[model samples]
Target chain A: MQVLARHNVAVSGVEGAPVIVFAHGFGCDQNMWRLVVPAFEADFQVVVFDYVGAGGSDLAAYDRDKYASLAGYASDVIEIVEHLDRAPVTFVGHSVSTMIGVLASIERPELFDRLVLLGPSARYIDDGDYVGGFSSADIDELLESMDSNYLGWSHAIAPAIMGNEEQPALAAELDESFCRTDPDIARRFAAATFLADNRADLPRVSVPTLVLQCRNDAIAPLSAGQYVRDHVPGATFGQLDASGHCPHLSAPAETAAAIGEFVRA
Target chain B: MTQRLEGLPADVLCGYLEVGDDGVVTSANDEFLRIVDRPHDEVVGAVSLSSLLAVGDRIYLETHFRPTLQLHGEVREIAMELVRPDGTKVPVLVSADMALGKGGQFMRTVVFEARDRRRYEQELLRARRAAEEAEGRARRLAQTLQQTFVPALVPDIPGLEVVGAYRPAGDGSEVGGDFYDVFQLHSGEWVVAVGDVCGKGVEAAVVTTFVRQSLRALAVQWDDPSQIIRALNTAMLQHGTDRFCTLVVLRLLKEDDDWLVTISSGGHPLPLLTTADGEISEVGASGSLVGVLAQPGLADARYVVGVGDSIVIFTDGVTEARGEAGSFGLEGVLGVLEAGVTSAGDLTDNLLQQVLDFQAGEARDDIAIVSIRVQDDADEAPAPAPRADVEAKDRALRALQELQELERLDEAE
Candidate 1:
């Protein structure tokens, strides 16, 4: 286990086999990528770590003002890569983490070879020219709902997690999951994750990038994935036939095949 | 070791089934047949996927289900009430996805028992309702507490009529602390005061009550308006909490044909005066808020109120009340008085209504207004027109009186 930014990091597989660092998105810890990691563990070094404020991480180390901006997370990635002494490393990030990976790679291009950004969103709000599904007022309502139902956070967040109505309601499981987290920590992490805007960093990534987009991801839409592709120069875009936000859990075979081929190529 | 799939017991698998794109049932495990209460061969190729649903379930599947699948391409673990061949309903959760091939597409659906979820949902609904009720009760209690701090109506004064009003800051949420009071002092001098505390909630309300009582006590002993304010400021500084308050005090004395008003202000708005001729102006005051600094420097100004002349004293909630673009401020107060709300009750109600209208019913601060009209005392023997007016009218009478023999000489001639 590796300690990254006060988090307990678990790394498996062989050393120097094209290190694929898996970065998970908001609300979830590193365990969401468990199904995808095993596929590459035999041939490549698989690195998985919870974000400082998530999963089985040390909750005491989470700083509010420091984690207020996504750049703080991006800086943590750079430090993690530096500590591993791995250059030209491939980073596989999901949801908002995809944007964080891109920002971190741009800051230190020599440390990374390529990026695999899954379900990326440059801006969640709709402006005059951009429509990222939700509006400022919508997000405000979401925040109010979260605040009002703070005790039942898991159940409250289920609709937001499964933003697509196609999936069955997981309110029961979600409510239980929410109970696992300390309400104060979850509130702070929620503010940090959903409230961040990382549009400016998308253009700065000079590394070869790949976006594995789900066809009907409720949390992230296809247009948002296309926006990421358009912004990152020479970035490859691949649409997958997966439904949920966590494709590794829903359609592991397709996600593994796509990620495997992209890293090999 | 009997290998149960993934190292679990064989009986654990409640139900499992696979369906084709054309709604044909191709395969089913033992557990699936047991859940549907049907014979294995009887169910195969005989029933469509929608056939398993009841009439109500079919409607949901058609409207909310098919549209979501068509747009998003796949769905998983959605709860449904399945209809058995015996016409009995069973709750279950279903998950399915589309597989793209050389031909077109195929659907794979899995169903499981939903006993746990149904119970959990019922519990969640119950808890949510309870929480909502508690929140509603808290809001009502806060509102009731807020009303106690404000008076329902201002008392009428004889000889000179009086009007007063108050508005607390609230926007569909918690209440605030804004207070106004008019009490007759022991010396028959009426003391009118309006003030706003710094913060909100029960704490501010407590301080407001204390201030109201303390100022009333000080007014009884002190006749000078500025001295009363200074004494209140000292009392607040000594006994006040972390929160501060802004106050304005006015002392009214009945003068013949006019009323002498001694005004003292502490970080409060100036009083507005409307003359009998319909001209309006703000009676400005210069002082700091009470309980903040050691010496608030209370400033007192006097004004003579003639017959039909009315003066309006109010809190910032009146002046700061939002208009269409700018604010009501001193201008709105003057405009309301100019409309001729002469009686105490009318003036109070009209001014309060004007503020409420200007704010568009969104008053986020407490406001207080007190107005008094001066009555002309024409019955007090008229004061004999003074020595200056009498001296100017008759200079010849004075000169003739100065010449000692003027009256005798005039008679002899």
Candidate 2:
């Protein structure tokens, strides 16, 4: 039988319970949130879907140009939340997806209750009067590297691109699935997600926000996390014991607990 | 005439069967002659096995086909060009299975055509090559554009000497966002600034240019360095994206007959100062980085420079440069300075050279370093006496004048 594209968006708890939408960052699909999903499954309607070209979603839905920016990913989150017809959903995003969720919540404030940003950065480059941790030069070098190793674009770069180094090995059979993406689609998504800057939308987010910063992420450094807190008005900034870019992959239990308490409150 | 095999299924067994010891066609089914396209009488006994193959297939059959088939009595899959009597060539996968007699000697040969699979494989190879070429072009263009933004040399100034160097990052195709500019402010004071923007590409570069230009304007008109950072912050807030940038700006003033360097930082690394006595120290200004926070306070540092002292200002590319084990950091910068201890003029060249050597001569990020050395003031020197030869000439002229006076007196007499 031909494999059918299916997205299992489930709500296991009571119907009237609060909704929590888990948006995964680049490189992986909604599967990264699996470790944290079970914690809230009993109390909240946990919504998850493959972002266009990832996981079990229809591969035909991914457009190279549209997904070349975080805005496109943010649009997907908005659509999924609205489709579920949930009120005041809580969005928990990792890495650049945090900015994605922020932009989405800013557009439709009534759709979200609070934001749990895991390793968020408004900008990655250092400016004359700002310290974004990495500079334009650093990012340029990274992009150039990806272009040079086009043949190893998926199998080689994708593994090193996201998640944490503490858990070096792939979780199980996940590595194959991670590299199984269409390379061209992954390239476009990488360009869009990493290169995007959403500092402007930080002030526009009227919803309550909880920024869970990884203490030591090579990708999202501490300075960038502080920038997110400083810019987003009334946003709570809390440093986690996590060490890598994907806290959900490394320390999901603690990450989920933090999100759960914020959502319940 | 060759007899047609009656029981052979046409659709399932589209391939033809060639029967004989020398591989001459004894008989074939309807599908067999249709695939190879040969007249029954011509190919039945007279045709050599190699007659159906093109030149390439003839070479393959001679070099790789006959030996394996005769010795092993099995011909594995071999892609060959099949030649029709009409002189047209079609690519086909040829697999010959040798059917053995009671004594285990070869008897009949069955050849199956894999025309469909060959066409699919060729198409896949062509598409892969096209994609590779496109990626190569994009990488080349990105590298070329990145080179265009980096300045070849720092500006030349009298009294105070300045030197600058920029190293691009490891990834050749991505444009670096690290930039540094040393220009004489409109007020006649020299303003030197080095900063790293938040990300890479054309957008970050636009911000780099805006920040560089804004710094120059503010350094000329404004007095306080922190106020200039504030102005830049306001300007960036007006049109800048969510991304912010960090930088270190220094304004050099000729105060008390010696150079006084006023340094300001917006979450940038402190400037390293090397005195004439070879004492090295870091000037600290760790305030909040610009654009990240509203009304951010920029840290300002003031230090006096004696004659021959130097100040080195650099972006994180110089400090966080990845050597064999991650980043080299500030110690790497100081180590280079300590090993090759020299004045600012030589320090800039030596420091850049050391960084190049440490990175194995290939820079991974845009590294911008500006070294300013205070020199001995020419105005403090005493005027030199006239040369002895000129003095002798003056004495000779006086004697000639006295002789002329005597001659004139004789004339008057």
Shift in Å, residue B347, candidate 1: 4.2
lDDT per residue, candidate 1, B1-413, as tens digits?
A: 87566522335565665555444566666766777889888777677566676533342343234323433455555666666789776777766666664545656566787767756765775687777775675565455555545444444455676766666665534656677777666576677787787787656766776787788789888887778878888888888488888888888877656678888888877777888888888674668888888867777888887788887777778888786868887777777887885665688889888888887887857777777776544322222223432332243233223223433544765
List TM-score per model, in order.
0.42, 0.44
Worst 10 residues of 1 chain A by lDDT: A171-180
User: Which parts of model 1 are misplaced by more than 4 Å?
Assistant: A1-265, B1-111, B114-134, B159-161, B170-172, B186-188, B253-260, B304-306, B322-324, B338-360, B374-413
What tens digits encode model 1's per-residue C-alpha lDDT throughout A1-265? 2446466577799987778899877765675676688999999898887777675777787777877778788888887888777777899998778878988997899999989988777777666776575577655654553444343333322333355443435432222222134545656655565566677777888998998888655456677778888888888998988754567655678999999999988
Q: What are the candidates' individual DockQ scores?
A: 0.02, 0.01
- The superposed Cα distance between candidate 2 and the true structure at residue B93, in angstroms, equals 2.7
Give me the overall lDDT of model 1.
Answer: 0.69
Consecutive 10-residue window with the lowest summed lDDT within model 1 chain B? B379-388
DockQ of 2: 0.01
